[model samples]
Target: MTDDLRLVDVESKHLDDVYRVRSRSFGLLSAGDREEWLSDVQGFIDDGRIVGVVDGDELVAAARIWAFQQWWGGRKVPMGGVAGVVVAPEYRGRGVGSKLMRGVLARSVEHGYPLSALYPATTVIYRHLGYEFAGGRFRYTFPAAELRSLGGKEVSVRRAGPADAKRFLELVGQLHAAARISGPLVWPEDKVAEWLGEENSFCYLAEDGFVVYGWQSGKLRVEELVAGSEATARALWSVVGSGSSISADVEAYMSPDDPAHLLVNKEADKNTVIEHWMLRLLDAPAAISARGFAPGASLEVDLELDDSELAANTGRWHLSVSGGSGSLTPSTSTGEVLRLGSRGLSALYSGTPLATMRRAGLAWGGATAGDGAIDTAFAGATSYMLDYF
Candidate 1:
């Protein structure tokens, strides 16, 4: 919120210049040898997902967002994912970055996303702006020597073409619907086109029709994996499991529990876990409503989100949901409420246990009343995300 800095919308025409600015700003690649970078930038532009900041005639900063499907916690909610936030080094400390972020976040709001998710380069910087560490991802080392073999009816896998777009997306959407940690399933048409345009990137389907489970593999990595059931998930894993080049160090994200610890493979060792991304709920009602839930009757909870960043999300509210669909409304009663700020809420939102939140001194309110509600909200649920934008 600086007076001098101004925000501008970037269009397709300015993509090359924006990438040049990004490259120069981040030292990503040698100047002028940026054909691939330009191509990636153009893809975002073509998808109608890139936004830029201009200082008069100069493009000083740029950010990109992509609309893709991800597992939220068992339901797929439309998410505005922020990425490629780059500001020219010369303008780094001049409030240009904040202006660029304000513009993009505003656009995200305009786009009707309940939340904005990003993997920030620096958590402290984003935290001040209301972003919170929502969750962490785990990289599991499924040792090649201990890799399990597949059995029980070989899944009929077929290479999918452009004609299979509808089927692929539909099946993936169904698979993510029951996932405990999933994101939006609507694929921006342009991004799909870009993924399909590549010769080495292969999309695979395993089923007779619409119910098929699907995945996409890039040249050196099995980038995306989605399936309707645990069996289907295992079948898809079998496909990637056959490849020895993937390294014993297999990687996955948005997984609620630590995958390294969850895996039964005794040989899988030297596991690594680290905080990967942060998420900010802009529309708490919409976001809380969008999440899929286990069986629950009703619970009225009050949340005081951060004022600096989640200014609109602050204040007390009541949440009621049965099955999976729910509603959040302003609370009228202060009686028997579970009171907590955005920090405590963020820790809980990111898969931290209620007891852990209390133990860490990050939570407030009466423990006896608050603990039960917090535990109920997160019970049998988990979150998972992917590193793709």
Candidate 2:
């Protein structure tokens, strides 16, 4: 059924067709809503991001790659965030979605993005394309009053707007570096302005931290809270709980090791809603070299990667690490080989322990001796993403 379809870069004129396909794939959209959606798609097309599968003149399926920088072991790495995937209702069972995703994967490699990530509505399709479940955006809920007891010296914070975009990015970079995070998205300055201008949202900036939140059903909902220092962490969290008298609960997106959790007075019921996200290594060598490893850890191991989608990644690789840095080289040497599929390797790259992968049947064979070293080299704080899409 996909034999007659052609994959191409979506152009400005294709916005209407793209919107129609998305609306039908997702659900009905009002005229006003369609215009708003088309505007966003047009922005992506103008930047040469959207890829579409066309049957003659009709856009039957589409996907977009959001240019992003994601954190890995405290280092920022280029990431292609896949989103806005849609297949026409009539074409849903004809393999159009998979064909379009393959096109997107190829485009990601050509663009030099070593890694790719996405919040999946369904895992089967992405997993088939060599993407594996890697991390999550955790949502936590607790009483606002619990945060009132956290103590800190007063730190001055002021309202922030688009003008503060640069400072906000800098602060988040600092915070992520210190926390040694994984899978957090870094937005461009212009996009920061758009976020600050969102209706009903409130943003505050401090010397070393920032908080963006809004009201939801009379409760405080924090979209993001990044702090580089203890004082900043306490100050920002206190602000969220300051309205405890009126708002009963506060829900926020946070890392599992968020400092605010430690500051609370009682054992609050923390509901961690894990929104699963997947990862794929478009360029294995580049991805390996770009990632940061544990300090004082060193290892050398051979990997046999099985990647059916990207031929360049399917082979034996010699991975070496020292002093929190790593390098990868194509190898013919028959050393202790750790065999796994591309999806499994992507999961391991995101700090999933080698032992866990073996137990899950994603990894096995040769050099059981290197398991500890592999674990230590990739180990870091838990991975989390605060941004969706």
Structural similarity to truth (TM-score) of each candidate: 0.78, 0.95
Candidate 1 differs from the real structure by a C-alpha RMSD in angstroms, to one decimal, of 4.6
Candidate 1 residue-wise lDDT at 49: 70
The CA lDDT of each predicted structure is 0.61, 0.86
For 162-200, candidate 2 gives per-residue lDDT tens digits of 888899888888778766788899888998988998887
lDDT of 1 by residue, 260-310 (tens): 233335534454555477776667778777776555635556654445555
Weakest lDDT window of 10 consecutive positions for candidate 2? 263-272
What does each candidate score in C-alpha RMSD?
Answer: 4.6, 1.8
User: With candidate 1 superimposed using the best TM-score fit, by how many Å does residue 285's alpha carbon deviate from the native?
Assistant: 1.4
Best prediction by TM-score:
2
Window of ten residues with lowest summed lDDT in model 1: 210-219
